[model samples]
Target: MEPAADASAQSTAERGRLLFHAGLCAGCHTAEDGAPLAGGRPIESPYGTFYASNITPDPEHGIGGWSDEDFVRALSEGVSPDGEHYYPAFPYTAFTKLTREDMLAIKAYIDDVEPVAQPNREHDLVWYADWRWPLGLWKALFFEPGTFQPVPERGDAWNRGAYLSEAAAHCAECHSPRNLFGAIIDDVRYAGADAGVEGGSTPNITPSKDQGIGSWTQDMLAFYLEIGMDPDGDFAGGAMAHVIDVGTGKLSAEDRDAIAEYILSLPPIER
Candidate 1:
């Protein structure tokens, strides 16, 4: 039997909530103790430090005055509220894979949220790094849109895993290495990453026996996702711990399992 409209709407909203956490939107956007989407957090990077902009419903600083298209452009196109190019540090590249409906739900949830009047912080960058147009062109060359492509032969759980990794969770954005211009080197896949809060390397997550988690049990992977603790009792430090504490911690157990299943299926690359 078909579900009722109210039930469907509730389900959609609940899914929107799930996606928000799975995507780790609040982890970077808001101060650790602040409200959702209020957007006054700092993002440290090798290129330069950036501050998260206000995403609340405030007309001035937040996105309260934004139209549907405006929100869509910012998320999928990496364009700012005033049409300036946003740095890839915002992770719009990963968010680009969300379906229109999913994006709309997220936007709706943001609109329905309370607004905070926090001012944004400025970036500390070199001269050439200030160019926004170049970033736009770079996006044009590498960025692709629309939702995750489903493998028809894969089960629904596996497809869900793909969606989380490719779109919402955006594992590749961090785990994958980048080229000279900071664009992800797709050829390397998940070989490893050099970007971390303090200049440490993100370990290769491929199924490689030596360089990656080839020996990790499926249960351990799921547990790590939920708690950020490894089998050796080692907890992830720096920004990764932040991801675990906020993002993955909010995900459902089933969803975390899906991510593990999809990750286990990737090619085992020697790092």
Candidate 2:
């Protein structure tokens, strides 16, 4: 019989499976018609086309050899086991806010998944971008490694929303504009961005009366996330539609409401 601790670990891993869906990890790591977590999805960026890495348990080609500490470092510090710097394209900057417990849970869940024997693809980069050493400098300038810190003055729901949006879900990766170095502009977060999504621009999710989602009620936002339906009865399309299907749609009603509440609490931005 399985030990009690082992059974508890399994249950925790199951919860982490849901967290993985909410984090949209599968969306980026899964290639078109490819085995899930086998990777090879081409993410286009200003600098180059980055192929997502395989996260399966394949010993030769995936993260099967990674320790829990190794996985945590990769997610929170953007550093691989071999000390290589991961490009910001992986969004580890935002992932840095995840707690160690959540990170371990994610690792446990990944361990439970079937291994795929797919090899990783090299990134297609612009000229003069062959070296990865520059990423260290980038991290120095913009990255702040830490877990999400709740504001003491905020309510539990608001804090939960902040944690989910800023850390777990990394919503700013798509909605916020980036600078020349591909760093998000902190001052104008969630105001909208181009080139963040494939083929089309990411829309403003801020609360500005114009251009942003200020007119949207918290309930409306929650409904949209849960079902991809707008207040006008129209269904969402494109990448957002997929996000709803794979990510937010899996969230519990309480979590969805918390996300909405936190989003609505942000200062309004017009652009």
Query: Which candidate gets the maximum lDDT versus the true structure?
Result: 2
TM-score of each: 0.93, 0.96
Reference-based lDDT, each prediction: 0.82, 0.90
- List per-candidate RMSD values in Å: 2.3, 1.5
Show pairs that collide, candidate 1.
none
lDDT of 1 by residue, 141-229 (tens): 88776666899999999999989998998888888888878888887787788775335678888878888988887778889999999
Candidate 1 local distance difference test against the native? 0.82
lDDT of 1 at 185: 85
TM-score winner among the candidates?
A: 2
